[model samples]
Target: MAQTKNLEVWLRGPLPDMPPLLQPIAHALLQAREEVQSFMQDFPEELIWERPAGVASVGYHLQHLAGILDRLFTYARGEALTDEQLASLYAEGKPVEAADQVSALMQQYEQRVDRALEQLRQTDENTLTETRRVGRAQVESTVHGLLFHAAEHTMRHVGQLLVTARILREKTQA
Candidate 1:
């Protein structure tokens, strides 16, 4: 008797052959968030308003992080967008519009992160391993990769934002 192999595995072949419970991506974000929460608290309102010379201000960087996190969630759902789609939505490479209000942006950022975490928790093992088509950059990515990418991306931006904030502070104090 011929048996049909599971398409789930076939589609998710590029997915890591491991259980997601063991995945550290979520933990990494939690840790990064904890660290950044403290740093974000120290960001000066004055600095948030002033554009850094030849660079984005603290608010712009923070908003950018929020925007990217939202994009990652969009990709994880097997529904990626084209760059054009992003532009139409006003999220195109632009810093978050609510950069001045740190509390608002942080609240929204926390919600988005929580949503991604919840989605990660609900993902079935099979789905996590499947290869999903992303907009133009069709990398053989798994749900796990999408989750990790979100975390890593956040960390990268946090580092950049922190430096910008520090520079802003130094310039002002000088």
Candidate 2:
């Protein structure tokens, strides 16, 4: 996430050590991270949990960005959600005093992205076709499907976060 360049990540070139088939997933995650960083550069602390139109709060999106990655990555590893992970999931939207602040959430988010990228780098393309289970229902998906969904879901949430932040800032300024 410390990448400093004018070009988008994908255009910047292939990520080192990342498998060829997983390159786009890495790019998408990186791009989503950058967008979150940019949009949240000056996001106000007081507005972190504001749900302007009764939709999801910015805080929820931030917590979700990190939590979803952790959950999906855990599934990709052929594992179930640990106690701590399940606890984190339950605490997503409801604020906990100062801990839900923007900086802390962003830090968690950056760390998750870093961990996700590293996992992608270590992912063997040959294993992509192998089936994996998701959530308690144990729904089936391939490694590639799960990872690709992670990227897709990341981008989707980022879009929501960006718009929510923009609306909050604009309304507050006016």
Candidate 3:
């Protein structure tokens, strides 16, 4: 029932444990999370993996959202992806026999966001400009760049999920 009509996450006020400089990053992420969660509240389970217009499924979006956040946060910490993390990346979007329901996926996303926020809180604003490498490609980026990308990437996928879910819902109703 929470609507993002008049208010945004930033307008909601400052987040506890978040650095002033990183406030915008946290706001954008929390806003995307809220909108995704609200829009998915009544989404049909049967359509979780349905792909309309040949787009990626709702399940994929949910999983990718959580996975990407974790990976980006890891890079921000200056750590390479562990073997487990690599395996997770490979398994994303692949169907699972006992795949989690939308609620479970949402729970996982919430926990990951909590972890990301904690990391943000502990981040040193002075180091925001320090260079960081991403993945095996060693793509160069700054601490601030990675953090900003996390929020930006999340919002992008949230938009995708919203469109895909709406399409599936329309199909079901028709």
Candidate 4:
């Protein structure tokens, strides 16, 4: 009896404008973005930067999520990080005291995710295997690798951010 092999691994498709090979990457990035938005609804802004038990703060995760996508996509394009990007990386973990900082960070994260999706849409599947250099050290990786890592890393940080936000909210009420 011929049976269909595990279909879940090959089911990437249907995301508007995403390349056939890049659909999974786009889907993953969008899923991560939705998770962040869902978990952060009405999250108290005052605790965005409050690290619980020496872990990273929610604010740091938010900033790094955006910055990671931007940097990795830039690498995928075979370009060096610009001076502004370098400065953004330098600022990732620094806390801000501004009242609207959480909203600002959320906006930045969402914008980065949108940009990543657009890049995925425009990518040619033929170039997925082409080598790309990462960072000034010229670390070698393929276009596919960089795009996959961008989605993976964004979800990783979103998980951490959600945990941190929950902990901060719980602590505030205790």
lDDT of each: 0.66, 0.93, 0.88, 0.87
Ranking by TM-score: 2, 3, 4, 1
Which lDDT tens digits does candidate 2 get at residues 60-125? Answer: 999999999999999999999999999999999987566548888999999999999999999999
Flag regions of model 1 displaced more than 4 Å.
1-23, 82-100, 136-140
Question: TM-score of the candidate numbered 4?
Answer: 0.90
Give me the candidate number with maximum TM-score. 2
User: Model 1 — which ten-residue stretch has the worst lDDT?
Assistant: 6-15
lDDT of 1 by residue, 1-174 (tens): 334242322232332433455246565555556656777785666556566777766666666676677777677778877675477346423444554676766676677667766766667777666676655767767766776788888888888877877788788789
Candidate with more favorable, higher lDDT: 1 or 4:
4
Locate the minimum summed-lDDT window of 10 residues in model 4.
1-10
Winner by lDDT: 2
Error of 2 at 102 (Å): 0.5
lDDT of 4 by residue, 46-79 (tens): 7887888999999899999999999999999989
Models 1 onward score TM values of 0.72, 0.94, 0.92, 0.90
Q: What C-alpha lDDT, on a 0 to 100 scale, does residue 147 get in candidate 1? A: 69
Where does candidate 4 stray beyond 4 Å?
1-13, 96-98
C-alpha-based local distance difference test score of model 4: 0.87
Clashing pairs in 4: none
